[model samples]
Target: MSSVPLSFEQLGSYSPMDFLTPHYRQQLHASLQYLQRPAGTLLLHKGERSLAQYYLLSGKVAVDAGPARQTFEGGSPQAHMPLNGSQPNPATVKALTDVSLFAVEHQLLERLLGWSQEAAYQVSSLGGMVEEQADEDWLARLLGTPLFGRLAPSHLHALLARFDYVEVEAGQRVVSYGEPGEHFYVIKRGRASISLPSAYSEQPALTLGEGEFFGEEALISGAVRSASVTMLEAGELARLHREDFVELVRPTLIPQISRNELARLSQQGSRKYLLLDVRLALEYRLGHQPESLNLPVANLRTHADSLDRDTSYVVTPEGGIRSELAVHLLNQLGFDAYLLGEQPPLAA
Candidate 1:
């Protein structure tokens, strides 16, 4: 076992790590686990499943695959890739010398890889359509948003194709409080303020600049808009109709799980998942699942950095927009979250 300082530069040298965008690489670095094993230690037996993708940082490891045996050394070109492939590793692996390794959750690695590929494809698809430098800049910023980063390539392309461009004048209200949410809007060239009705005095209004988005809460929950969005200046916007948003984006962004399924998952997995109630603290105090954690949806952005990325969160379904909004925010922040379904089947 060893305590070695691993820099971002050394991390950048790994295969898929080299392929990831800087932003994605930084996100991966936050929760990456550093591991070390002494010489003669058994890393993995043949046919054992690996939950993480491990990369050799230093020392030597011997791999035995059937009749073939090979020794891999750290800093070698061969060591730049994951020591173990997907689950059920075919090779028996042992540390030949004291070894240092960095392990990324297998699912996390795959998700980041998928997003990286989709982002590159999106850039390519833009081609000659990016007319101005400013347009190019905003497009890049838009791509960096968590919503866009998480979308499947097909859904991304389709959503991009379906957006309707709109021009807004300063002080115009795009969507007002209590109105049904008709569209999800992405700011292309302007600023806007989001504020709830005067009755909700506790929460302050928020400003959003270009490349930011809004209105998803209403669309996802089938509820009226809780806040009004007013343009601060004349700006361009790209809006997706509610139907399009639901059809093209909802499936990927907001997955739902029945209560029974969640119970079954808890019983079957070694990993423990958590239930999150996203209603306000007062609302939570009135009634909430005893085991669930209460963190209001509005405060999720501010508090989410402290959350465990390895744990999956199930948002309670009772709060409608509040719960769904929390799921969206959590997913955007790179947390695994699912909405609890409204109905659960009778126990057998």
Candidate 2:
């Protein structure tokens, strides 16, 4: 077998695929695995599960199901789509002749397609305003983000509609430390600075630019803002009201489990769950769940990349807000995370 990069021309005739935006079509080139197989090679067996979508590229293939069989030629209408679209593939597929094919992860393709459709609708909904065209880069960035990518198209569209655009001048305070969280903000045109209070360790401040978001930490936790966010320069922001955020975004992104449910999970030997306590090191030293890992909420984003996405994480409840915030951040970063509801006594 061999591998080859997919070109736009090669995918132009495929259904649904043709609907994807040019940018996403290009992005698919890197994710698709191209392969070559000799005649009579069995590519897929009946009743087997497949996580990828396979497309015939350059030869004929035979699809057999029970006593019926069909021959599909490359470039033909039948071959333009995936060899098998159902789970536990109902048919067996084999090469009728030396063949070349490409496969893309099912979930990844679905996400790109959803993003493309949603973005197209968003731009067209604005009547193709010049400003919308100009902000296409930021829009694409927002859509490609893990959090946004996972949202259903309908929910994403609703969230987009609820956002109110606002302008800020340099040095304007967008969110102040100790203030109740009200709205979630996404930078649309310029930059903002994040400053922690002096009482906290002097960690350097953070700067956020277009396509990046803030206020989620406070929103998820339902706590006072831990840091102040100020405009570094004149810029535009897309703000979602607290109510809209809680209703549309929060429930979709963060999954939750009760302490009793967690105990039930622990009883099952088939799956192992990781417990993460997002409290301060001192707090953790004093008391934490047995065998739980600790990584404070303040430092979560910085070290989030090092986490193992394959491991399911249950954020341990301390103040409840911190655990919720940690789970929100984990989900936003594409980790399999669940917030543990109800705080249990920490082990001494």
Candidate 3:
């Protein structure tokens, strides 16, 4: 343990442990060291071995792992807990600016909490708050949000655990159209909007809000993004990457697609009426209309020869940007094409 003693005065205007109870806060203060870090520094990296649980005193830190990357402003002290596994040392801890931190080794924390009931209670409470934060973060990134008015606590808790936190500033493009969609996002704080290139005219389509989630279709089907999503407000977000999504959320969601909708599209299968799945190649492989040809909207023009001009085509894309754009594209090519399902108009 470092000999540097902690003073309540040094905690500045920020709460010592915003996530902890008063009793636990007192316990934590007894066993922490306050250290300062400079800008452009990395505090931790993905797949690092467990170390001390760091409580940020001041400044900011970025946590990057796989498809979930976020930067957190350590306005108040926040704890850092390493995941259990084959621990790789951190890749970097470069500072973004001058930073102040309170460090406590993991073993020391376990021992302290193990010995003190008050400490344990406080830590547990803090843990609950951390978990809540994760949920809020996830909901904020969605583009077309479901009505969450009736979600149960148990259901909400299950959803929260699967999300990874992301942070972005205003004017940043989170997802771009014509790129592979790998994850879905929900906002925790701030705001974002969807943007699409206009086909009929030069005007672009745009929509903005919190709680709304875009890219739901791509997330399920492994398709390319149908539109671009950009942050309109600077804040935090929670994301569910593709792997976690498939294991945790997909099974529950797949059953919700009505059988009637499936049959309606299937009934259209014939020589005169062709099903053109406008989803990307990877998405088409995941699952699609059995009789539909996998011609992604981007490559539709190039692959025009594959389709007969006399055939009436049905354009079906996952959601938002892709389907509408596809309908417009096929029309430009002089194919009698119509979108299959009812949904929000393509972003302007």
For 170-204, candidate 3 gives per-residue lDDT tens digits of 99999898898788676666678777656523434
lDDT of 1 by residue, 267-300 (tens): 5242457888888878788777757788888778
Q: State how far residue 310 of model 3 sits from its true place (Å).
A: 36
| Arranged by TM-score, best first | 1, 2, 3
- Model 3, global lDDT: 0.54
Runs of candidate 2 with Cα error greater than 4 angstroms are: 3-15, 26-63, 70-80, 92-108, 126-130, 199-204, 255-299, 308-324, 334-348
TM-score of 3: 0.34
TM-score for each model: 0.73, 0.67, 0.34
Give the clashing residue pairs of candidate 1, or none: none
Error of 3 at 199 (Å): 2.4
Winner by TM-score between candidate 2 and candidate 1: 1
Clashes of 3: 30
Candidate 1 residue-pair clash tally: 0
Residue 72 displacement (Å), model 1: 2.5
User: What C-alpha lDDT, on a 0 to 100 scale, does residue 283 get in candidate 2?
Assistant: 90
**How many angstroms is residue 144 displaced in model 2 relative to the true structure, after the best TM-score fit?**
1.6
